[model samples]
Target chain A: MCAELIFYSVVPSEEPGERAEIETFLLRNGLSYDEGIEIFVVGREGRKLVACGGLEQNIVKCVATDPLYRGEHLSLTIVDKVIHLAYERGHSHLFLYTRPNNIAFFAGCGFYPIVEVPGLVTLLENSPIGIRRYCDGLSKSRQPGARIGAAVLNANPFTRGHRYLIEKAAESCDWLHVFVVAEDASLFPYCDRFQLMKSGIEGIARVTLHPGSQYMISRATFSCYFFKEKNVAGDCFTAVDLLVFRQWIAPALGITHRFVGTEPFCRTTGKYNEDMKYWLQADLSAAKPVTVVEIPRIESHDRAISASEVRRLLGTNDFDRIAELVPQTTYDLLSSKYRMKAVGSHTSATA
Target chain B: MKIIKDAMAGTLESSDVLVKVSPSDGPLEVVVKSEVERQFGEQIRRVVADTLARLTINEGVVIVEDKGALDCTIRARLQAAVLRGGAVEGLDWSILQ
Candidate 1:
């Protein structure tokens, strides 16, 4: 049977029960509330809210989804509903108080911050409009102690440069959980991107692919957060994937190490690297904190090759340069779909 | 790796390379022999001239034995050779002052 998705506004009779559930869920999820607010739940089947979110008209604090049902972009859906409702009800601006990690997810859904109060994350759970039920169903769906090594790759379609990084990390780990960015928010769709990474690294054993649904829905680390003006210079906002991995995935599934490419290509990545280093050193007391391995950038024509440069050249229809910069298969795949767009077309907006 | 051993030790054959620099003419060049020119002669000349044009050479001549160097490598070796030759005292001081 097709999964039926439903959306509804909360009535006065359900306030006390929903508020209690919200408090319990917030406490269980380590959230807090500071002001009276409103709450809503969106679910696929009756009496089961797959996602929950609400806003405080006075303070603009809202929490959308629990740790479960995270990768489905359910949080974005919930956030979208709340933003629309808030606007329709005569509020020109809406604010969401979120954990620093989930900040990107909210930003992707078009919410911005006016101020950041450290130690205010708990305020979200304690607020009047938070989730009430503290169900462990989401936590139970994930297998504990499942060692997953995650790589937040921009795999501009994998090249030898990318393969080298993956191979290095795979050698040391049992299951390499390669997270593919699924947001169609990229130049290539998630399917094509996954295929390229898989085909490029076909020989590697014990590697599995997970959809970086969190990343696709994230706006904080990319253009979205910047557009929203929620970022701070030294604050170094974390990606939703990294935040989810730390909060929900790492503790729930047991991620031992995180693989990342060297910061030769991106400033966004440089900031991510710094934030991850700080977290690994600080709060990871259960399992050993996450370790980062900088994948070596390959050299060609005695110059270091990068995805950005390749994309730039591709915009000029320079397949020959791409072949030299990337692997043969990557060159072929990129050229077939992207080559036409090269001749005077702009680079992918996501890039 | 081809060997370069011939009767004229300093003179550049069609295959031999003479690398030098002078401040007045930046990385200037004059091939002693032109018979053995290869496929990308014009391109190679342009590459060399274009690369040298960026330098502040007053006067100098450079000769090269390009078996098959891409534009990038040729430029690298040319730049290296000019720097090396620039260090020599009184050999050809006209261009690299």
Candidate 2:
């Protein structure tokens, strides 16, 4: 017999009760909300959310259905809505992660299996021109020895600390792939940030700049840094994102080491890097084996030179103080004819 | 005002209300179904009835299936539905009302 179901999209910021319902259901089912991503849920007339999913960029994640609502075809129903929503938003490609046992279920929903980790996680895509395009772009300029290093940087305005991390990583690896966070949610637009990254690494002979694809700047990772109040997204949040990168992106590019700058003040980032440390060490997959290298932040005037501090100084119109924290390239951008109008939405004092 | 065609506005999603109006000659029939009926049923009915009264709509069958929408969302959606139902042109969506 078929059961009637109620389905709807929710703006968590607008509807607290419905958001709580979905959150409680997800927690009971052993899933966490990837903050900053859009979420949709199916509920009963009484307002108890039973099935739910989130969309971050082109990925559909955190999909969960309450046990009581099983056999109702709720998973596919939620997936279909998200797929239509993605198409409406102009996303031609979509990806999702689920336990290894459910590969056939998603394949039936038109997803092609990409990678299956030994333990329980699997990645699948719904596009015909699937992951090969991404793999080819990742290894665009392959170098020898296979000891490639990877770093995902927003580099809102690349600082000396950023330069130090890349240079430190370059010292040990044959090639370094620096992925600038391409999510337009950043204070500095992607183009300006990409320009700053290029200029920051211009002198490094080994560093190559690439946009961290849709999978990188996930709501699962760094996008929701300041939205922790909406949900308590601990290390597991970043771990999910890093696991996807490790299982899907790193191996194809021959990247053996992932470099990150240590966070001293931001609790969210500090916990995120810590989670990356745990996952990389505990992940025993032959194809997913990776070493996470967290470099000590470069210090200036007894303080860590950081993008957040530069943003703070920019907001206060303290160009001289900002000049000291950033590299010559960023300083040039700040002072040039364009006269970088300070636009960061986030800031933290340097410690 | 009289409803002319079978019309609907708003999504079936939670926190929204879908109002379907069908043309009817029988005494104006209003049927209300709501998720939050225990606490907000009377309020929901009042909003729908008040909107119909403002439109002078007394000759149609109106069905409101509500899912805990706020007063304003219900108001906006019902207004949109009434305008769409009449097959008329003067949809005064100005918030003054």
Q: Is the docking of candidate 2 incorrect, acceptable, medium or high quality?
A: incorrect
True contacts kept of 1: 0.00
Task: Compute DockQ for each candidate against the true complex.
Answer: 0.00, 0.02
Best by TM-score: 2
DockQ of 2: 0.02
- The local distance difference test score of each candidate is 0.51, 0.70
Per-residue C-alpha lDDT of model 2 across residues A1-351, encoded as one tens digit per residue: 545677777777688887777778777887766565665645564546677777766677767777876752666667666665665565635777676788866654556566554444555776323465567556666667778889988887789889889999998899888888776766677788899888888788788888766667553233333234234335434555666677768877788899989898788677767777777767455556778898999788999888878877777778888788888888888777234565544642111
Worst 10 contiguous positions by lDDT, candidate 1 chain A: A126-135
Fnat of each prediction, in sequence:
0.00, 0.00
Runs off by more than 4 Å, candidate 1: A1-148, A215-217, A220-233, A239-241, A284-288, A343-351, B1-97
Encode model 1's per-residue lDDT on B1-97: one tens digit a residue.
1111110111122232323222222223333212234667887788777655544433554444443456676566555555544543444334322
